[model samples]
Target: VNPVDRWDGTPLADAVRAGHRQVVEMLSAAGAELKLDVSQTSVKLCDKAREGSVEGVRLLLDGSADVNAADYDGRTCLHLASATGNLMMTRELLKAKANVNSVDRWGGTPLADAVREGHSSVAKALLEHEARLEFDEVKTSSELCECARQGDINGLTMLLTAGADPNACDYDKRTCLHLAASVGNVAVVKRLLEHKAIVGAKDRWGGTPLADAVREGHEQVSELLLAAGATLDFSAERDARELCESARLGDIEGVKLLLAGKCAVNATDYDGRTCLHLAAATGNLVMAKELVAHGAGVSITDRWGGTPLSDAVHGGHFEVAMELRKHGAELKYSRLKTAGELCELARVGDTNLIRTMLAVGAEVDASDYDGRTCLMVACATGNMHVVQVLLDAKADPSVKDRWGATALADAVREGHAHVAKMLLAVGASIDLEPSEVVSRLCDYAGAGQLEHLELLLNCKADVDAADYDKRTALHVAASAGHLHIVEHLVSRGCRVDAVDRWGGTALSDAQREGFTHVCKFLEGRRQLVVLKRSSSQEQLNLK
Candidate 1:
């Protein structure tokens, strides 16, 4: 009842819709008030009222449910009841002091709902309650922002005419005019300008409407703002400074503009760090690539005597380091090293250095001082790219570290399903005895890795593999709500009714964990299995 669903539908609505009168009565007695926000189409009370359930409506009203709670779309219970042509429900709502002229999200009142839904009696009843025939309603600033977002000029006018603030700022301090200009809503922009919306208003991000238009490539919107006294404000020294700042902030838009205006790509900031150096330090591959394309030298050293490639490697941007290498930036860190250095590079995701070491006859399966192999370190650190590189070099995933854990175990333990699947696919031996093999299968099943589970089953791993608590892979899959894995296990001849040590069947486990889809699947499979047994018994009797 407290944690509403994504649509903001409450538990009370669910009870009403399910016709659970007793639960509704209890919840009502607990003081569950009807509250509809912007996303709700209609409330549970309204849904009940629309179905002509007078008792349900009465129960809700007795519980102090507001008769006039409007959804984001502005549809109330009376509107729903009128549209649904539920005369008794409408009368009950009207009698409960429901507002007759409450407008919906679309600004239609209950009388309009009645008229449009072909309920003349409901319309007459609403008119009797002083309901207006015309469509009109006050619009809030939020509604004006929504109109601006949708490029709805007519909606903007209606809201403006109804006294909505032209310069109203939303939660983020973004005015309606800012939103209109961001999406290049020219008509809405002009309308807002006519209503005297502040042209120089800055949002929470310090971005004005003109800056937003320029950033988004809205040339017309930019020109309009410029004609309305917005300045471009690009100076030579400022461009050089902003270039490095954009590279540091990873602001691709600002960098692009500065680049298009022929600004120096290799311009140094006050600290003597060029744009390329900043991009490398920030590990922004796209920004680095853009800087490289604009003639920024990757070999250019910063004030601290670090090249862009050195900065990339030091910042753990192995991908950026690789890109710099592709552009002929000399590798400085690929010199010969002990097993410790290779392990360190692998741990840092320096795939290029690993490749270089391997090419120079360095052992691909070398263990660190702590007895952890490069493969184990990569898998444990959740570095999939480095893991793939080591795997391609034929590094053994079955090698145990100091604690007797293999790369496969590390991948599964770290929730790296892709890495675990790769290990299994590449024939990393699960050569443990029966019980340990079953435990490994349960790990993959628990991780919800359908691909890994299928691979394990193909590798002669038992489909009915169970862990320590007698929890089968089915129990694991059901608890985790992996429907596909559950179906695959059942189709692979795994027992449908296998119970764990807790005396819980897969169905019961799914139910306990609130995995509704898995519960339905397990229940359906169990019923089908029962029906087959019954049919077979019936045939034997006939024989």
Candidate 2:
């Protein structure tokens, strides 16, 4: 007679549902207890609360029914009362000391459901009963986001007033401010901002409130965020390499977000291309102007020396070229295609591009803004066929870069000995003096480029060449603890006793820097060799 239905409702629940007082009393008297836990049901409490039956809930509470018992889905009596906007039953449950913050399976608290269901009075009552919007950050953030996304200002206010975090974020770190700004909810945004919500908080994907506002064309929201001291997010922008790609794809909206986030106006990729370069190549004149207005230099060059101006001209964007010239970009290169274009083609290792550009009357011997020639670019990248083609076209190999590095010097510096030999065959100059010695040997040794060091020495570069402080390759090698380069330099007859301006030899440098192996080798070798060279065999014999 007391069997439960498939919905977890017993005969007592049916009696209560139909308001049959005599049967409810008879069922209770016939051993029908209302208390049930997790897997079963908080059936009597939930049904009474859902029907706003204050007396039914009171009878159960007086019958020793557990006030905090929840159903299988974790929906407690308080959750049902609050969700149905039943203030009387909610207050009755609160009077019985109900768990106001009980979470349902969907992570909804009583206050959260009340707020989301537009039950302002019930939410207020729940808040007055000290109903926490969230005891869990994940659970609470979801409720806050629900209120914000629906533009329910009253519920949002109650949550915030009850000490809910203004910047509650979901799993993706998408904050309520991001949602509010994106939806153009000005009043909700104002309410959140009043609670001190971060105007430029970035999510997991680097999406910020202000960026969201701008991307969604919410001008007023954007202005509000900007007025709140929202600027670039350099930390997020560094890891986000999306700006260059956005510019290339003509995604101006995404560019606005990335540009606002990425502080560097001239930020470049691994290919050394900037947003301006991408915009010019794609003929996005509007994006180019935006970049220029934000202090992007039109004369900025890529790894192959391709500038925004030259890229614009090469792409036949005459309007973009004219616009670039107005921003102090000079058309300094000769002919139809710029020298930077030729240098870029040479760097690509495409022999056909070189021939085609050259056939179009492109200047071969001219230098780009970086003062690097096509032949130098070709030799630096070790593009054999491109180098041969340029050499055959009478491209001058003698031109030095801005760093005063000839094509041969560039080749040798990059360890391209084969290309260096080719440049030498064309009468390219080589100077293994102080500049070359310091740049090539010391740099290679300090960077632990033992192969480059061996190549330089094999090319007959001065073994003991030193810089201004008289710091040689051995000094840098020892200081940097490159034991292999130190041993190789010692084998090549570089003097260990040669002193710097500080009067410290390579041995002392190694010892001071705590290089045990280098110190041991130098200490053992020092005892075998004379400190100062003897001018004559008689002087050596006397020593």
Q: Top model by TM-score, which number? A: 2
Q: What C-alpha lDDT do the candidate models reach, one value each? A: 0.74, 0.78
What digit string (tens of lDDT, one per residue) describes model 2 on residues 1-543?
557677766676666556676777777877885434433348767888888888878766654478888887888889998889888888888888998888888777998778767787888888887777664666567777887789989878877876788777789998889889888899999999999998878888777887667656577888888898886454424423456666777878767765665557687777787888888888899999988988888887787777887677677676777788788775345532466678888888867656645554467887877788888889889888888899989988778778777787777778887787787776766654567666678889999998788867766788898888898999999999999999999999998888999999999999999999999998877876753443455587888
Any idea how many clashes model 2 has? 0
Per-residue lDDT of candidate 1, residues 330-383 (tens digit): 534322233566688877888877775565345777776556788887876789
TM-score of 1: 0.37
Deviation (Å) of 22 in candidate 1? 40
Error of 1 at 407 (Å): 18
